[model samples]
Target: MLGGGGLVAANVYASATEGGWGGQSGPDATGQVKSAGMATIDCPDVGSRLTNVPDGARADVDRALAELDRQTASAYQQLQASAQALSADPHAADDSVMNPLKDKRSATIERIAVAIDRVGDRPEGLESLAACALLPGQEATGGVTGGTGQPTATASASPGGGQGQGGAGQAGAGQGGNGPVASDYADITAVQPNAPQPAQQADASRGSFTSDCGVNANGLRNSDNVIVAPGVSNGAHHFHDYVGNQSNNAFASDDDLAKADTSCVDKGDRSTYYWPVLRLQNGKQERDAGAPGGGTEGNAGQIVTPKQVTLTFVGNPRSKVTGMPRLLRIITGDAKAFVNGPANANASWSCTGYEDRQLKDKYPLCPSGSDVVRTFHFQSCWDGRNTDSANHRTHVAFEGPDGSCPEGFRAIPQLVQRIVYDVPAPSVEDGGRTVPLFAVDSFPEQLHKPVTDHGDFINVFDESLMRQMVDCINSGRTCGAGGDGGASASPSAGTGTGSGATAEPTAGASGTPAPSASNPSELPRTDATTTPAHTTKHSAPGEQDGRGEQGTDDTGRRTKQGGRSGHGAQATPAGAGTSHSAAPSASQAGEIGQAAQSPEPGSGRTTPPPAQSEPQAVHGGLAETGANLWPAGLGTLLALSGLVMLIRAKRLRY
Candidate 1:
C-alpha cells in the first residue's frame, strides 16, 4: 500500500512539473530519472544509503519543497489580486502582473507533487501528498503485493511471495516499480488569461523615406527626364525643342527631359503641331519674317514679318568644336497643302496655334481640308549620324509647312537660312522656378470655390455665428430669446423721455447726431413720477417766440415742467394696464420672461446614470459563486485526501 501510495505521489509530482505547476524556482522539484522502472527522488531526510538510491538525494530538496508552498501561496494571492483589479476596472483585467503569477502557480503545483514523490515511504512524503491532493492528478491507486498473503510481500509467478522476489520486491522497497502510473489530476489553481505585454516602442529616427533618398520634397528627382517627339507639322518639317535640342538629338543630361520619351510614330500622322507663341518681355513685336517690299504672289494682305521670335535649342550635338547650327526652311505658298514626297511620307505630324486655338480650325489654307494654313520648315544637323543610312550624305532633308506655324505668316525664304547656335539664356520668367500641375477636374468641389483667402473661407460662417452669439450674450440678452430686454438706454442721453431713448452705443455705431423725429407711441414707459411728455423741438434761436402761440400746449395747459406739456391731459402712458408692463411691446416682454426661466437646449440634461453605482445582479448568481470557488476548493480537497493516503502509506510496513 505504501509503495503504491509513493508511486501515485511521484506520478502527481511529474504531472505538476510537466504541466507548469512547479512554480517560479526555475528547476523542477521532481528530478526526472532516465531508468524505465525507477524515479530519482530528492528530500532532506534518509542517510546516504537511501540518498544514492534515486529516492533520497539532497538537503536542498527541503528548501525547494518549502518554496513550493510559498509559490502556491503566491498563486492564491495573485488570484485575489487579479480579481480585485478586475473588479476595480474591467479594463484593468489586461494588466501585466497577472500572467507571471498565473504561470508560477501552475509550476508550483507540479513541484509540490515532485517533492511528495521524492519523500516516498518517508514522513515528509505524507506532507507532500497532502499538498498534491490540492493539485491536479493526485488520486491514489490500489496497491499490488506478492503471494505471501502479506501486503508488503514482493510479487512472483506465485500469487504471493516474499520480498525481493519479483516486481513486487521493488514496490516493497518504497520505489516506483515499473515506473509511476499516469493519471488525471486536478489543476493546482485556475489562472487568469496572460496579460498583454507592452508594445515595444519604435525608434522614430530610423526607417524613414527621406533617409533613403536625399530629395525631401514629395517629388521625383530633377534628373529624371521625359522626352516628347514631334506630333505634326505643316510646311517643311519644323521642330521646336523646348529643352534646347534639335530633332533626333539626345538631351544634354537625363534630367533635361520632364518624363519618359513618348513616340507617336507608327500611329497615323497627326494633322497639326501646336506651338505657343513666345511673348516678348516688353510686350512688343521685335522682328518680322516677311518678303522685302511687296508681298509675294499667293500671299496678299499677309504680314510675313515676325515681330518677335525666340528659339530654344533642346539638345546638344556630339562635337563642341563647331556646335550644331540652327536650320530654318521657309516655304512661300500654303505649306499644309503640300503632301509628303515619297522620301518622308510616313513621318508623324501635328500642329498647334500660337494662341491655343485648334490649328485645324484657325488656319483655312492648310492641307487635309482644315483651316490651319501650314508651311514647311525643316532643320537638322549631321555628325555622321544621319536618319537615311542608305544615303551617306551628312545633310538630312526636313519638311516644314504653314500648318507648323499656325499663328505666323508663311514666307518664302530667299535662301536656305542656317544660323550658328549658342546656348540662349533661359526666359526670365522660367529661370530657376518649378511649378507643379495637377488635373484640375479631380479637385473636390469645396476646394474649387473662389475664396478670398483659403483660411477665411474655412472659418467664416462658424466664426460669424459664434461672434454674434457671444455679443448677444454679453449684451445681457440670452440666446433663442426673441428680443432685447430693458437694459440701460445710453449714458449720453439722460434717463427721461424725448428722443433720448436710443440704445447704448455699440462699438461699430456711427457718431452722427440723432434725427429730430418723434414717435411718442413707440417710446417705452418710465416710472409715473418722471416727466410725462417732454418733446425735443429743434429750431433756429428767436425763430419762435419764447411764449408764442405755437409753444402753447396743445391741451391748453400751461407748462409746469422744464418743457411744454403734451397735447391733451398727459397721454395714456405706454404699456399701461397690461400684464406685459415690463416693456412697451408684448413680444419684448415674452422674450425677457423666457430668458429668465429656462436653460439652453442640448445641455446634457438627460444623461444616463453610470453602471458601477448600481451593480446589475446577474442571473444564476449562485451558480457563478460556486463556479468561481470550484477550482481552489476542489484542489484543496484533493490535496488533503492525497495527504491522508500518504500518511497511511508511511504507517503501513511492506
Candidate 2:
C-alpha cells in the first residue's frame, strides 16, 4: 500500500457504519469518536515509484517531486496550527488543509507527467495519487506514543502548546513538540542477540578498509540534501552533521566537491558523508535554535557531537569487489520510513557491548556503562552502469539474501559507518522525568521517529585511492592501518572462521589497531602526518556559525564555515545555482539572506583540518585514542525491530 493508503481506505469503509471521519459508535463513556486525535497527511510516494524517468526529464521531475514534498510539509504545519479548529470541526481539516493540498499536488503531479511525457511516455493514474488522507498519528500507522498513555505530540496542540521546555538555554521541548516518546526505546540487555552471520564462501573477500574522519567537532551542519533535493535550500527539513567534504551544500557541483578539501587524514579522499544530527532533548539550544531546519522546523535541542565516527569499507561475501566510480552518491536509509513503511528502511541501532542485538524501529536503552551506537551499511551492489539513478536508489542495491549481486550488478566495496555517542540513558519507564530523551532530526510529519534515521554519502576518492581500496578488499589484505599501504594481516584475522566468539570480527582484532598505548596504529593512513594540513574555524561554546547553520546568502549560496551570518532565512529556490559563491554577510549581501564564506586558508581555498585519532570505547571506561575495529561484514542483511537507549559511559576527553 502507498503511504498507508490502506488505512485511509479502511477509514472510508468505516465511515458508513461509524458516522463520518470523526464519527463514533455508541460510546459507553463519551459520545465522541474514540479515535479522534491528531493526524498527519499521507500520500503515495511518487518519487519512489518513478523508475523509468528519462535522463532529459529527470531534473524537472525531481523539482516537481521536491515541490510536492514541500507542499505536504506546509500542509502538515498548517494542520498542526489548526489543531483547535480541527478538533472543533473535523471538516476544517478538509477545507483548510487536505483539499488545498490536493489541488496543489494535482497541478504538480500534472507537471511531472507532462515532463516525462515530453521525453518518454506520459504516466497515467497519477492524478489519483494527488489526494491524501489525514491519518491519526497514533492509530493504524505505527505507534508514536511514548508509553505515557498520551497521544503523540502532533495530536496535542500547536507547536509549543504545553510541550515541556528544554533543559538549559534551549527554547522548547527537545522534540519541538513532535515526538520521541518512551515507547521509542528498549533496553539492550533485555534484547536477544539476533545478528546473523553472513554466509561467506571460501572465495569471500574478507578484508576491510577504514577511513578516520573526525567526529565533526567543527560543527559543520546544513539542511540541504544535494542528492535528493539539490538547489533547494532547507531541502531536508531537519539538520544534518557533515564531515569529509568542506565544500558541500545544496548548490555544490561534482567538480566543486572534487576540488574541495577533506577532513580525512588521507587527502585523496574528498568524499562527503552526512546524516541527520542526533540531538539531546535536554533542551540546551545550539546556535540554530531559531533558524530554519533547527527550532523553526521542529528540530530542537543541543546537537550531540559524535564521540567517535568510524568509516569502514569491507568486501563482498560472494565476490571480488570493484572500485566505485568517483562521485557515486548513496543514501543508506529512508528518511521517510516512518510514513513510507519499512520496505526500504535500513537503520541499525545498538550499544557497543550489545551490537549483536541491533534494532531498527526502537532506540536501544543501554545499561549504565555502555554508549549508544548508530551504524549504516550502504548498498554495495552497483548496476555497473549509472552512478546514480532517477530515484537516487535504483542504480545501487543491497546484495540478495544469498549475498550475491543481482543480474547485471557488480559488488563494490561496501561502506560501513559506525557512530558512537555518550548520552545519559532516558528513564523510559518514568517518561524521561530523570534524564532527557534524544532523537534524530526528522521531517515534521515523521514525528521524530527512530525509523526515520538515515545517512547519505558521495564517494570522491581519487582514482589512485579507490583502486587501492578495491585491491585491498579483493586480495583480503588488511591495508590502511598503522599508516601502511597494502599491509597484510593474519589470514584468519577478519575471516570470522576461528573457534571463539573473538573470531567473529569484534572491535579489537585483525589489522584494526586496538586502543592500546603500546600499539598506536590507526586505520587507513597513507601518510603519518599528525598535524592537520589546514585550519578550520569552529564556533565557541554557545556561539553560532551562520554560514554552517543552513542559511543562504543574498544569492542563496550557503557560505563556507565561519562567523554566524546575520539572520538570513533559508533559501527555497526551484533550481540549484550553476556556480558557487561566498557572498558577503546578510547586512551587506542585500535583502535575501546569502551568507559569507568562512575565512579561507592561505591557498585561498576552503579545506578541513586533518583527522585525529578518537577515543575508543572500552567496556567500562574510555580507552586511549586509537582506531576501533568494526566487523568486516557489518550491517549486511541486518534486521531492524527494537530501538536503543543511550547510557553515559566514561567520557572521552579531547
Candidate 3:
C-alpha cells in the first residue's frame, strides 16, 4: 500500500531514488543514441475500478479493456521509436502519440459504456479516463549513477564474459533501449531484515498441502494472459514461464483448462501456474527475440528456466481453511505497478542464504553458490461468493491485520510460490557489461523493475484432490502426493518447508517419472508418478532458449530452496516492520525436522513432522498506503494564504 504522499514522492523523485542511469552524459563515446528522459504513456486504470460490471457486459468490457492494454503497448512502442524526435520537441509526444492513443481509448471506452448501459446502469467517469500523458521513465542520458546517487562511470559487459568501455547507454541496448541499468540491483547482505512477526493463534490451521508440479522443463512459454486478455494474443506483452496445465492460451476457457493434461505429479491437480520469465542480457536472442512479446516488445536476452518451483497451500493462522472452488482464478501482484503505482504490487525477492531480508523493489545480488528467489504470496481470503470478480480482485481478499478474514470472506488455502533460478549475480557497478545482467521479462514501459514482478494461478484441481488439500490443511497434517512434502528443514537452510517439490520438466511424450531426490528435504521429494505427457510447444517459432542449453536436473537435486516465507512479509505492503530475529520460533520444534543428510536416490519418503511454520500469510485486496492528497494540498494552500496576510499587515504597518 503506497500512500498518496508516498506515491507523489515516488513519482517526483523516482529517478533519483530508483537510480535512473539514463543516457550518455559525455560526448566521448559512440554515435547518436536515444537520450535520457525516457518517457512512457500513462492512462487511468479502468479495469480495476469496474467492479460492478454486469455479467452480460463482462465479455464486452473485458475485450475493451484488453484493447486498452493493446493501445498502451502500441503507444509505448511509438514513444520509444520517436525518442530523438520527442527530445528535440516536447510537443511531438502529444501530436504523434498521446492524442492518438487517447482518441482510440475514448472510442473503446464508449463501447464499454454502451454495452453496460444495455444490460445495466452504465458507469460514469470512464470517459475521463480516456486521456493519457507521458510519464518520466528514466533520467536524460547524463552522468551514470549507482545506488549512491553520485556520478559514476560505467563499462559494458558482453555475454562472453568480456568487458569494455562502451557508451553509457550500451548496457541497456540489448533490452531495446529500455532499462535494468546498474542502479536496479542491490546486494542481499546489505538489506536489513524487515519482515514483521505473524500473530500466534490458538486455532490456526497449521497444516499444508503440497502439489508436485514440475517446473516448465518442457518449455511451455507464452505471452497470453487468459485471465485478463482472453482471446487476445500477446496480451501480456511479455513472456511467461508456465507449469501445470499445458493447454492454457489466450483463448483457453475454464473447460479447456479443466480437460487439459497437468504437469503436476498428482493426476488430480491440473492447476495452471505462471510468472514472467527471467532473462540474461547476454546478447543471445531467444526464440521470441523477433516475436511480438519478445524483442519487438523490448524483452530481449536468453530465458533462464527456474532451477526449482515450489507450490504449497497452507492453512490460515486465524481459522480453519475451506476448499477453493474449481476454476478459481487468482492474480497476485500488479504487472503494471511501475506506472500504475504500488497499490497492488506484491513482489518479494531474496537469495538462498538471505531469506530473512526480503526486497520489494530491488533485485538481490546473490553471492556465489546462492540462487535468486522470487516469492509470490497469493490472496488467502475468499469472498465465498463468485470464484472470480469483475475486477478479478473483489472476489478474493487478504485477511485483516488480526489475521481474520474480512466480513463476507472466508479463509482458504494460501498459495505460496517460491521460484528459484541459478544464475550468476550481475555486477551492477559495470552495468552488467562485464558479467551479463539478468532481469525479469516486463512490458517495455516497465523497464524490468523488480517491483513489477508478479504471478498467476488458475485452480483446476480435481474434486478429490481439492478435497484432500482442504482436509490436509484443516486437520493440521503436512501432506503431499506420496511423501514429497512430508519432510522439512530449517527456514534458514532454505529447504523443504514448503509442501511441494521442485517441478522439473518431464521428458519424452508420455511424461517422465518424477525425479528422485537424494534428500527429500532438499528437493521436497514427489511421488514417482508421471502424468500423461502432452506435446511440448513454444509460444512461437524461435521462442526457444538461445543459450544455457544445459537444463537443471529435472530430478530433485537442488539443496538450497526458499526460506520459510512468513505472512508478515507478504501482508505488509507498506514495507513496515522491525528487523526479523534469527531465533527459531517455539513452534519450530514440532513443525521442523532434523534430517541432516541427503537420502540416496530412490530413498523412501520421510514422513515429515506434523505442520511446518505457517506458510506466509497473504492479506488480500489493494492496501491503501499514503493518505489522500487533497487535504494535504489544502493545508499547504491555507498556510501560504496566512503567510500572505502576515506580509500584507507588515507592509501596512511600514
Candidate 4:
C-alpha cells in the first residue's frame, strides 16, 4: 500500500510540475493533462488495512513528498517575489513571467487534485493535499488593466523594448476610441511688425488747371464793352485829326494847342470818349390842311416847302481840336452852308430865305433819315501860331457832294474855299519842310471800344430781392400785406364754436388748471413801453383767481392771444398775453398768433429761437479774470511742446 501511494504521489508531482496546463505551450510538447478529484476533502473515507512498507517504497514516498515540498515552496516564493517586485517596481509582472507562471500553476493544481484522488485511502495523502494550496500563478496580477508589466526600455530588441510597442498600442486605442487631438499654435504669418507701405503717389499732371488756381481766364473778358458804328442815340463815338502853323513867332496851332493846352478840350485825345446825340423832325399831315378852294391860285392857299437841316456840336467837356479836322461831310455838298447855315440863309434871298431858314429850324435833322451827312475839316492855325500857346489859328474846307445829289446837280462840291493859310513850322530833321505829328489816319477800324466803357447806361438791378418777391407770390402769400389774414393761425378748442376758444387741448396739456384772466403774469416785460398799467391794478385779483384754480381740470380750456386768456373783453396781465394780441390790428393777428404758438427758447418745447448771445467762457473764473490767459503766444508754446513730445516718443520706440 505504501509503494502504491508513493508511486501515485510521485507521478502526481511530476505532472503538476509541467508548464503547459496554463495554455502556454513551450517547445517541449507536453501532452494535455486531465483534472482530478478535489485536493481538499471534507471527510476521510474508510478503506482496506495498512501494511508494513518496503525500503524502496519508503524512499520513493519521501522523495515524492520532498519534491512536492520543493515545488510548493518554489510556487509560494515566486508569488511573494512577484508581489514584492510589483510593489517596488510596479511593472515587473511582465508578459515574460505571466505566461509561464499561468501555465505551470494551472498544471500543478490539476496534478495535486489527481494525486489526492489516487492516494485517497492512505494517511500520507493528507500532507499532499495541504501542499496543493500553495500553487504559483493566477491571471498575471500587479499591472494596470491593459498595461504591460515591464519597464519602458530604450533598446528596441529587449523584452522591455516591447514597452514602446505597448505604449503605441495604448495611444492608438486612446485616439481611435475617443476624438481628435487638440493643441494651440499661433499663425505667425499674420503678424504685421512694420508700418504699412505708403499710399501710391498720384500722377501730378492729371489734375485740372482752373481747379488748382481757383480762376478761369475766359470769365474775365465777359464784362468788356460792345462797340457800335456811327452811334446809337445814347451811344459813344471816337475820331481823330491833325493841323499845323507857320507864323515865325508862332504860338501853337490848333493841333498843337489840342495836344498840349489840355484846357478848352471838348473830346478825348488819342484815347476815347463818349457822346449822346438826339434829333427831331417836324411835318404837317394832310388832315391838318383845311379845304383849299377858298385860297389864292399860285399860293395854293399859301403853299409852303418844308426844309431839312442838321445841327452838330460837342456836348461833353473833353472834346479836342485834333479830332475837329477829321469831321468831313463825305456825302453832302453844302458843307460851309450847313456849318454856317443860320447865318448864311439870313443874307441870301432875304425874307424868303429867312422863311426857309425858319422852315429848316422847324424840321431838325432826323438821325434815322435818309438825307443824313457827317462833316470833316482841317484847322491849321488859331490866331496864327506854330508853337503851343493860347492863340492857335485853324483852317476849314469842303470835300464832296457825293452821288446823292438832287436833279441836274454835279456830285462834286460846287465851291472849294480855304478859310485859313499859314506856313508850317520847320521840321526837326528837314530845315525847310514841316512834319505834322497830329495827322489823322483815315482808317476807321483802328478805333476800338475801350474796356472801361460798358455803355451809356448799365441796367443795375437787385436779383435777390426779385427772387424773394417771386417766391412769396408763388407760395400763395400776399406780397405786400392783407390777404387771407388768418390762414396761418392755430386751430381753436371750442369745435369752431363759442367765439374761438380751442376745441381740443394742445399737445402740452397735462390736466393742470387752465390759465385765468386773474393769474399773475408768468413772464415780465423788460420794455416799459410794452408793459401795461392795468397789470399793477389787477395784481391782487389775478393772484387770487390763479390760486383758486390750481390743480383743477380747466388747464387748456381758453385760447391765448398776446399771452392773454379771455373770450373777448377780459385780458390777462402784462406779459401774459399771447404774441397775437400785440399784432396792433386784427388783420395781422393770425400771423402773430402762429409765430407765438411755434416754440419757446431753452424750454426743449419746440423749435428753439436762434442764439442771440455769444457762449459763456468754458474755463473757470481764473481764465475769465486773468488778462493773459489766452495770449496769442501761448498757442505757439503748446504747439512746440506737442512736437517735442512726439519726437521723444518716436525715438524711444525705435
Best prediction by lDDT = 3
Error of 4 at 305 (Å): 30
Residue-by-residue lDDT tens digits, candidate 4, 294-400: 00000011111111111111111111112122212121111112212232121110010011111111111111001111111111112211111110111122211
- Give lDDT for model 4: 0.19
Instruction: State TM-scores per candidate.
Output: 0.13, 0.67, 0.68, 0.11
lDDT of 1 at 501: 13
Which candidate model has the greater TM-score, 1 or 3? 3
What are the lDDT figures for the candidates, one per model? Answer: 0.20, 0.61, 0.62, 0.19
Query: Which 10-residue window in model 4 sums to the lowest lDDT?
Result: 208-217
- Candidate 3 has a TM-score of 0.68
Comparing 3 and 4 by TM-score, which wins?
3
Error in Å for residue 313 of model 2:
0.3
CA error at residue 586 for candidate 4, angstroms: 48
User: What is candidate 3's CA lDDT for residue 524?
Assistant: 18
What is the per-residue lDDT of model 3 for residues 376-425, given as tens digits with 9 covering 90 to 100?
88899998878788888999987776779988889989888888766666
By TM-score, the candidates rank as 3, 2, 1, 4
> What ranking emerges by lDDT with the best candidate at the front?
3, 2, 1, 4
Error of 3 at 475 (Å): 1.8
